[model samples]
Target: MKKQRVVAFVPIKLNSQRLPMKNILPLGEYSLSWYIFDSLLKVKDIDDVYVFCSDEEIKKHIPSQVKFLKRDRYLDGDLVKGQEIYQSFIESVDSDIYILSHTTSPFLAANTIEKALSKMLLEDYDSALSVQKKQTFAWFEEKPLNYELNNIPRTQDITPVFIETSGFFMFRKNIFEGYRRRIGFKPFLQEVDDVEAIDIDTKEDYEFAIQVYEQVKQRAYINN
Candidate 1:
């Protein structure tokens, strides 16, 4: 049997509604997208790293070893959803498996991805997605989502719910062929650290992540 090809897919666009030019914005010692690229480069499991992007300028920031994939012209704008572009990319590319990375979530470490890939393949999971266990009171509308009104459990006692942090995702390339989505059935919820799960969406989020990174660097939590 032939060895399966795994691609590290990164989706980036030049424009941003919330924070303009956020992808190219500086984070720590590198741009936002560059952080994600840097992490992916350290992973040995990935055979290729392709940036699914609309901006040609992004090439200047990412490492030379990384490759690029021009996104569809229609999906180039801010109005299009990230999932739509990913689905479109899935249709255009050919690979055995894809590891989706987001520039918005720069804290994902290479070793974290390597472990997820190993478990995903070994367990034969259809999909693997990074999640953070949020142990807090959650409500939808007026009603509590995770706890009863009268039988309120302590925050610690309450079952923590995993939020799809968009940290990273892994799936066989063909998994989306039938499902028309990136996350397929029988998905694995790979729990990651709270700080590592930080996603950059707004200016506040960006600032918070910066503080988190500065404070936590000495620990060097990921693969050493």
Candidate 2:
């Protein structure tokens, strides 16, 4: 059996609608964009890591081991859908398995990624994605979805809802090529904790993430 090629890429655009140039926002010694790039490179299963960006400036920030794939700026437009950008990337880089990750999810742990990758490869799952388990009362169209209004159950007792996070998505090449989706028919929902689920999108989100990151680092320092 031939060894399956696993490639991971983080698509970064210089411009952002919310929190302008949010990707390059300073987290600590390194910028916000550095965390995910550092994390992906640590994953042993991943053959190669690439930063798919439209600007050449991003090349300076990424690690030397990580290859830079310059994408067309046209894809960075607000009108352009993510699927179109995804299709463009997959076409450029051929791999047996591809990992789609975002810089916004800086706290997405490598162990979580490894576990998801293991599940996908071992269990013959089409794809694996990070999700947050919400066990609270949920409603849709002003109607209760998880619980009934008549019998208000405890949040703990309620059926947990799995919400997808921008943490990561591991899928086979065929899944994307065939369906044009990161998720397949059979997807393994890898539940991640609150800390690991931090996805920075807005100004508030970024601030919160910095606070959490600092706390985590302090805890680690104390432990060591």
Candidate 3:
């Protein structure tokens, strides 16, 4: 049997409506794209990594090992949706599997990615999405989302909610061919750390992520 090939898709755009030029934001010595690019390269199972974006500034952050793909100016606006672009990407790239990641995820850990990849290939899963399983108080309109007002139960007792972390995805290339989506019918929900769930969409989110990234780095250093 032929061995399956795996590649990572890291996409960033020049325009960020909430935080303009957010992708170019500096994180310590490197930019946000540099962090994710280096992390993807750390995954031993991945055959190659690709960076797709519209801005030429991003080229400076990319290493020679990562293949860079250009996006036209027309799709660089806030009006463009991610699903449409990814579907378009699927049409162009050929590989056995794709690991999707975002430049906003500067603190995305290589260990988390390696585990997701290993699980996907070992268990024969068709697709995988990272999730942050959280237990918290929430409401929709006047009704409580996860608990009853009368019960007044502890937060720990409440059933957890699984939130899809757009941080990353692992899927067979065929998933696009079969379902026209990144995930297949039998998709696996891979749980990731709460901090790892952060993806910068707004200015506030970007600022918060920097503090969290520092804490994460400190924790890793102490543990090591």
Best candidate, TM-score-wise? 2
Per-residue CA lDDT of model 3 for 1-224, tens digit only, reads 67789989887886777888788887766777788888899999999898877676788876678887777776776788877778767677888989999887777788888888888878878888889987987777998888888887788888787889877888898787777778887778888886778888888888898888788778979999
Better of 2 and 3 by TM-score: 2
Question: Between prediction 1 and prediction 3, which has the larger lDDT?
Answer: 1
- Stretches of candidate 1 off by over 4 Å are 218-224
Please give the CA lDDT of all the candidate structures.
0.83, 0.90, 0.82
lDDT of 1 by residue, 22-119 (tens): 88888778888888888888888788998988777999978888998888678977578767888877777778888888888888877888888887
Model 2 global lDDT (CA atoms, 0 to 1):
0.90
In angstroms, the error of model 2 at 48 is 0.9
* TM-score per candidate, chains pooled: 0.90, 0.96, 0.89
Clash counts per candidate, in order, are 0, 0, 0
Q: Clashing pairs in model 2? A: none
lDDT of 1: 0.83
Candidates arranged by TM-score, highest first: 2, 1, 3
